[model samples]
Target: MLLRLPTSVSEARECLAEGAVPIGGATLLWAEWQRDGFPALAMSLRGVPEAGVLGRDALGAAVVLHRIDDRVPDVLRLAAASVGTGAVRRTATVGGNLVGSTLRCLLPAALVLEARASVLGPDGVRETDLSEVTAKRPLLLGLRWREPVASAYRKLSAAPGGRPPLTVSVALHADTAGPRRLRVAVRDGYEVIDGGAPHDGDPDTALHTLRQTALRDLPEAAWDAVAAQVAVVLRAADDV
Candidate 1:
């Protein structure tokens, strides 16, 4: 495979517009590509000077992942759970995991935190919410997020190998002009959050369903209790 390392975001954009597949850290892509060849041209973004920095934005309310920095602890924890094993964690790029259509717990966490993306595309530099960009596009340049009121991620796996989680849930608590914003996302099959609607039910009902759906391996009643416990903790945190 041929690789090109662009030093700046503009260079990366130019290459992408010319039909080059942008790769960050190359952890996820390499695994899938090695098993099944993809036709697109490849570029390794690892050498780019800006590929690895994590910084807070001017307001100091959010976290931004630049191209040059290693994945943050929270991000690593999320990725480690997804693929399992230390080897995958080392190679998987936060950007790569987001690019995949599969529902990752972190994406919603970023959304709950009010994260945005700074994308350098052929048209020019554009900023959009990370959730919106990931849903609409196949690629991502970077991710940014504002300070979250509260956030939590939970996943359920059936076997010991830590295989892909059977179900995952992420909750973000934010204060809005209206009611306190409680955004909950559940990943099951290709559908995330049962048609992508935010939970509008009572906290008990919402938590019950989330846990039951996410932890298929566990008994419904048991998981429901667990879900209730999580909801209580999250709600309490939000209150504080």
Candidate 2:
């Protein structure tokens, strides 16, 4: 495999134009590599100083997962803590978590947190919502988000080391009626948005009520188990 390390966003963009797959923290890609092997020409951002900050409102695409802490945001801390082990978290990057999340991945963490993507393409830079830009595979310079009034996250893994089948992230903001800015993203891209709740933490309650509603729609024992786990994640998001 051919390897090239880009030192800046311009060089990274040039490499992208040359058909080189950009590599951030390769925790996700490396997993696929173990299964399918390496690509032809890989442009690594290992030396890129431009994408290395874990800023309060914007995290550089190359920001290491483990670099985030309580000083950042509780919602983000909750999501980062739910990833694999310490070793994997140490090598994972913000962009990798968003782009390489693939299907049923943990990217809903970013989506529900109301983060924005700073995308770099051949044309120029564009600012877009996380949901809109994730599918395009843009060269991500960083992610941005403002303080949401309040936010929380929860994950329900099948077993000790299993992939979390259910993850619930919620961000709410104060308004005249109550918590007006409500956002949610779950498994399979199941999304919710609104002033659905009248106060803080009510989104979690609304999600828990979904179990009863789901119970009426299905008769299977497995769906019941799923609903139960959904309750667990949402409740955890509230309490944690």
Candidate 3:
């Protein structure tokens, strides 16, 4: 397999233009490579400083999960901390979590935050909504968003730690002249974005919707536990 290490955003874009698949952390990508073999061309973003920044309201694609702390938004920090073991977290990247198929670790928070992605694609670089990245699966450079008034994250899993079967996240955006906007997202497989809150913004109804949708495949008993977690997180977020 041919590998290209790009030291800058522009260089990384050039690699993409040449059909190199972007890689970071390689925590998930390595697994895919082991099973399916390497891509013809691959670009590692680790050397690119532009892809590794963690700012007040923005996060570079290559920022490692372990680097996310109290400095970032609460919801994002919580999700990042929940991703994997200490070792795995140290190796996983924000971009990898955003683009990965098996475990979209940071997706719930990103969606609820209404984060915009800086993508470099065929049409050249552009900033677009996070939802668009979900649909188009573009090469992400980083993410940016307006700070929300409050945010929360919750998840239920059989294991005490590591990956979870389902996760729910909500972010409250306050408006001075209007009612506060609530963005809720549930992630299991394909995420369900309930742009508005559930039952005119009831957290319980949101969990019910989660039960009916994302958690439907799990055993019936598991629903109650998941609901409890969602409730706790929602209430905590409300207090924020």
Best model per TM-score: 3
Candidate with the larger TM-score of 2 and 3: 3
- TM-score, structure 2 vs. true: 0.72
> Residue-wise lDDT of candidate 2 within 37-107, one digit each (tens)?
88889987766775776755667788778887876556677778777789988988777877776642446
C-alpha displacement of 153 in model 1, angstroms? 1.4
Model 2 ranges off by over 4 Å: 31-37, 103-106, 160-163, 175-179, 188-240
* lDDT ranking of the models: 3, 2, 1
lDDT tens string, model 1, 22-127?
A: 6765655666887889646766555444444455421111112222222332322353355534565565566666665365545644554456776566786677
Best by lDDT: 3
- Clash pairs (backbone) in predicted model 2: none
Candidate order by TM-score, highest to lowest? 3, 2, 1
**Lowest summed lDDT over 10 consecutive residues: which window, candidate 1?**
57-66
| Per-model tally of clashing residue pairs | 10, 0, 0
Q: What is the lDDT for 133 in model 1?
A: 64
lDDT of 3 by residue, 147-187 (tens): 87777777666565544466767776766676556666666
Clashing residue pairs in candidate 1 are 50-67, 50-68, 51-67, 51-68, 52-67, 52-68, 52-69, 53-68, 53-69, 61-147
Candidate 3 vs. true structure, TM-score = 0.78
